[model samples]
Target: MRGTVAHLVPVADPDEVATIIAASKRAVGAAVESLHFPLVPGVAAAIAETDNAWRALEAEHGLLDAAAVSRMLGSRGRPGALANDRRSAGKLIGVRRRHQYLYPGFQFDAARGRTRPAIPALIAAADDAGLPHDELALWLCEPSGQLGGDRPVDRLDDADAVVTALSAHVGVQW
Candidate 1:
C-alpha cells in the first residue's frame, strides 16, 4: 500500500481492456504468492518487524553485499560458498533480500581481512538466546547506557565487554 503504483490508460476497446485486466490479475496473484503465501502464521509479522529493523541497521551501520563481504574476507570463493562458510563458522551472518545476501559491515574488519573475533561469540550468544538476526542487528547498532552510550559495534575491540552485554541480554553468563 505504501509503494508506488504505475498509472495506465484505461482503454476503450473491450478486447484490449480484457487483456490488460487478465495480465493484471496474473501479476496480482504472483505478487500475493511471493509475498505471503509461503509464509506460515506469525511469519508475516516477523517479516514486517524485520523490515524496520533492516532500515534502522542501514541508517546506522552500512551493509555490504555478498561480493563486498567476500572481498573483505580475502576470499576468491564464490559469494554463496563464502556465505555458507562464514555461516558454518558462526563468524558472519547475513539477511536475505530478494534472493541476495546483505552482510553487516560491522561484523568484519576489512583491514584485518577477517571477521572480528567477537562476532562469532556474539552470534552464538544471540542464537542461544533465540534472538532473531534482525533483532540482533538492531540491538548491535543501538547505543547503550551501560556501554557509555556507545553502540555495541563500537566496543568490538573489547570482546569481553561485548560478550558481557550479550550475556546480560539473554539473562545468562556466556
Candidate 2:
C-alpha cells in the first residue's frame, strides 16, 4: 500500500522505491498468512462468510464487468470504455468495488444487445429523487414491500410498475 511505501522510502528515488516495494510485498504476504492463523478462526470465518455472500449476490444478479458490458453494447468483442462513460454520466448504475465497477446484468436487454430502454429513465428518476447510486443497487436487488415483494431488478422491463414502486419508495413522483 502507499502507506507502506511512504513510511520506508523516498517515493521519488527509484532505487529506494523498488527496494521498499519488495519489502512491502514480503510484509503483505506475511500479513496474508497471518490472516488464516489458528488463533483467528472467528475472524477468518467472518471474512469467508462475507466473501461468500458477495459471490452469491454477484452470481444471482449476473454482475458484469465493464468489458462484458462493452460487448453487450455491440462493441465488436472488444472491451471499450462505454460502460464507465455511461456510469459517469449517470445513465448507468455501476456498483463500485475496490478498483472497478460491476454493472448489474438486468440493465441489459440480451435479445437486443443493448441496455433496456427504460434504464436511463430509471436512473434519471433516481437522480431526480436524490437516491444515491450505491443504495439504488441494494434497493434494486432486494425484495420490496412497495413492489409486492419482488426485487426491482426483476421487474425493470415493466417501467411503469417499477417507476411507481420507486416513487413510493423514495416519496417522490417519477
- How many clashes in each structure? 0, 0
Query: Against the correct fold, how does model 1 do in TM-score?
Result: 0.64
What shift in Å separates residue 159 of candidate 2 from its native position after superposition? 0.6
Which regions of candidate 2 fall more than 4 Å away from where they truly are? 1-54, 76-78, 172-174
lDDT of 2: 0.75
Question: How do the predictions measure up, each by TM-score?
Answer: 0.64, 0.63
The superposed Cα distance between candidate 2 and the true structure at residue 30, in angstroms, equals 14
lDDT by residue for model 2 (66-137), tens: 988987887764475888888888777888766789887778887898887767877888898998776676
Model 2, position 60, has a per-residue lDDT of 79
> Model 1 over residues 1-174: C-alpha lDDT tens digits?
123122232356767767776786686567668784364677644664566567667766677887777777777878557866786676786766657667887888778888888888888888888877656777887786667788888899898898788678667457
After TM-score superposition, what is the CA distance of residue 23 in candidate 1 from its true location, in Å?
Answer: 22
lDDT of each: 0.73, 0.75
